[model samples]
Target: MKEWSVLLLSLTAAAFVLFAGAGTASAADGGKILIAYFSRADENYQVGYVEKGNTQVLAEAVAEATGGELFRIETERPYPKEYRETTEVAKREQNEGARPKLKSTPPDIGFYDVIFLGYPNWWGDMPMAVYTFLESYGSGAFAGKRIIPFCTAAGSGLSGTVGTIGKLCPGATVNNAFTMLGAEAQEFSDGTRAKVREWLVGTGLVK
Candidate 1:
């Protein structure tokens, strides 16, 4: 009976070691994450007069799920508070290929192994400020890093922004993008969070 008891104890210890090793392996594989996004508050499409922009809400949920650091991308000159006026400004910026000046210095992106970029889809593309943010880092900063994009849009979804990121950061591994309606993100925050968590799990960012 004593020999049998010793054998059971040995099996339990082995199981514990195996499980612990797996947890460590998972943590090692999941590198440090950073959630950087551009969001605008005020009169927005669908959800009007928001203090927190739709993209900001979504980005915050992503940060919560992945435990990533949050960085907001703001322009030196704010966009119009009115939705129509903002769209016009966005269109002009895109037509001119303009790079709006950023309001703050960017974080040291070299410290993060994974970067989750979020923005609101404007005129079927990322806002011009996001362009400035990416270009500010220079192409070399993103080399060998994993970039995952998410967006809140009216109807454009990701609007092929994932491909654009690949073009901009050629050395970085750009993963598939996740997108949701701005209204859904703004109005149904709890559901949005759940969906974001599920998507993160599929992307291997969360378990």
Candidate 2:
């Protein structure tokens, strides 16, 4: 009986250490790829449905598929409440070259090799929050590392957003860019997840 108890205790300790170690490694390889995305937690109109936020759903799926970390890119000053008003604000801000302050600090770039950036299409480009995130970490820190971006766009595709990011971080290798609409994200289907898996595998970022 004493021998059995000792065996069980040893197994428990080993399991704990292994899991803890795995967590540490994940945060380091960009295998811990942080899902940094700008998703407003407000009224979002899709093709046929309404969503509070679409980026969150997409980011969650990507994180699950890639076994990575998930982080929300929120604004210190929230967007307008009404949809039309929000669009107006976004347009004016874009024209004036305004950068919205983010409420969250990005995850440790030291911990990630690949970063999956996502956001809803604002105007004909990325939201200003993304620019803010880039400005904070644009000093060639993650050079030679890969950055994979995905988005939930409305009318526009990537719309030269990837190029903009590349220009911002000249040291990073950017690829594996993709997009999905908000209404499509609402389903969270297996097909969408399969595509995600393929992208991760194809990029050689995961098994």
Give each model's clash number: 0, 2
Q: Mark the regions of model 2 whose C-alpha exceeds 4 Å error after superposition.
A: 1-31, 47-52
Candidate lDDT values, in order: 0.85, 0.74
Candidate 1 residue lDDT tens string, 89-133: 999999999999999999998888889999999998999899999
Candidate 2 TM-score over all chains jointly: 0.79
> Total clashes, candidate 1?
0
After superposition, candidate 1 runs with Cα above 4 Å error: 1-27
Candidate of highest lDDT? 1
